[model samples]
Target: MTTAEAETGDTLTEALTEVLSGARARGGLFHRAVLAPPWAVRVQDGAPLSLACMLRGDGWVLHPAAPQPVRIAPGDVVVLCGPTPYVLADDPATEPGLLIQPGDCCTTPDGTDMCEKLALGVRTWGRDADDPTVLLSGNYQLYGDLSTRLLDTLPPVLVLREGEWDAAVLPLVATEVVKDAPGQQLVLDRLLDLLLVSVLRAWFARPQAQPPAWYRAQSDPVVGVALRLLHEHPGHGWTVASLAAEAGVSRAGLARRFTGLVGEPPMTYLARRRIDLAARLLREPDATLASVARRVGYADGFALSTAFKRLRGMSPAAYRAEHGAR
Candidate 1:
């Protein structure tokens, strides 16, 4: 086998890590559940991603299209990408007793509120306190448009079995979720991000995994260095010739190889990266539109606003307002 084929696995892993980092968790929902037998909760399709871990006892995750529900044992982590509803229950035969809607709202099937009724303690909720089953669940609410590349690559359901990955941060997240102190939410958000990266790292390492084209293209010697440079310095004014020179290849060779491997020309990819970075910066209160524009390679706020509105369907100020940023 050639050098490119040999290093494909390592390059794909690095590319996935880079892509996933673009969708950093802002403020998500975390809940600690303690339940007993004969109980089930129907999770609606709203959040972009949902993560559940079996902390104690066992349960089953039922999907509508699956022939059989998946069993979840202790230490098992499951990630569900929506909008597809699923059920978590003690057994596959159990009917859903409660419904979970967007914004973490809970209710009965008949539309009666259940959030306050099932509250156990800080960040804790379930049918019973001394229940046999315990679970740690998190929901990622806000993901930028750039995350579509990574999210589209994932399956509807992914399960990482116990001992398959290192989850040292799980315990820390479980502990911090119940804290009512200041900055506790921030702590949980960071921990959830770590958990997600760790799980994906393990999943992509499986031999049978079929990574995306861009991920696979990172193995090429020329494409790999160019990708790194583009990702590391999105604000730099990069042209085809400049990128080719930096990667030690002629302009024509680099353009052909990069387009063939990555499915897009180098300049197009760079533009997308700059827009992604600008979106993230717009969420900061101190970062003005002009400042964000300059930092992301645009000439001024007007140039950035035009592109942002064209690509994101909103101006920078409108985007910030929608996201509740100052």
Candidate 2:
């Protein structure tokens, strides 16, 4: 076996796959926007994530914190880390006359619901149906604390220009999004995930890009294997010595290396991961605390509750109630 393979037993692509496995779109809101000049939309949906692709013409993304508006040319894709409001316009000066709220709620300046009133067609909306400025967008709610690990790494607004990477999926995404047919939601959901994964892969491949700490640890021969073992078998009772033996490293060596790279001790990191997994499981309507506890390596509900509350500052029950309301 190659040296790196002997240690980590996985490639960077495989690492990314393991991480993105949880990102599935369930009834995600998608729309095709065709707008003429003097157009802008204020998106304040408070979703965990959103993706926008410029299919034709040009536009700008205006964020409250940004000193300048970022330009989007045709075929460019943008990943928005949201819960923060932002505006899209033909020009920076064109103010938004409409507000897009949660649950696909759209309102005019006078607070009138215009969701169906402005429906151009199936999953299409805009001032003019034939407008040259076309944008396709998908809003996704990245439920569960597990997604927070991935989401924490992204900036509020990240644009992947066409020149930066080949947007091969753009054509398929554009075509699939507007279709009104059977199993369309499933098709769109898969397409959305594919497009997102492609965009993220391209972005991370950039020379100047910075990925999450856990992601960066994938390159380490020792820590990578340890992390993979922990992630793959989170339910396992992994002590430092056990993990070290499995990784073909001494316990002290593994401890120092893992802490330096992953920013936490082995068992501490495992505990956090377990709780994160538990938090995700608690989001499921049918999952009881005890079941989630066993799934994440805790002996029972009390043990799980202690760890979950200690780390997350909220009880599992409270976390479930809050997310259930969402």
Among all windows of 10 consecutive residues in model 2, the one with the lowest summed lDDT is: 141-150
Model 1 poorest 10 in a row by lDDT: 143-152
Q: For each candidate, what TM-score against the reference?
A: 0.84, 0.84
Kindly provide the TM-score of model 1 when superposed on the true structure, using C-alpha atoms: 0.84
TM-score (C-alpha) between model 2 and the true structure: 0.84
Candidate 2 per-residue lDDT over residues 1-326, each given as its tens digit: 87856545455676677667656676777889888988889999988888888999999999876678999999898888788899989999998987998888889868999888889988998867888999999978545522555676677888999988668789888888889999998898888778777888788889999887778897787888898889889998889999999999999999999999888899998997788778777878789988998899999999999998898888998887766622
Clashing pairs in 2: none
Estimate candidate 1's alpha-carbon lDDT, on a 0 to 1 scale. 0.83
Q: What is the Å distance of residue 114 in model 2 from its true position?
A: 2.4
Model 1 lDDT per residue over 49-140, tens place:
88999999999998775677999998899988877899999999999998998878898999898889999999899878898899999988
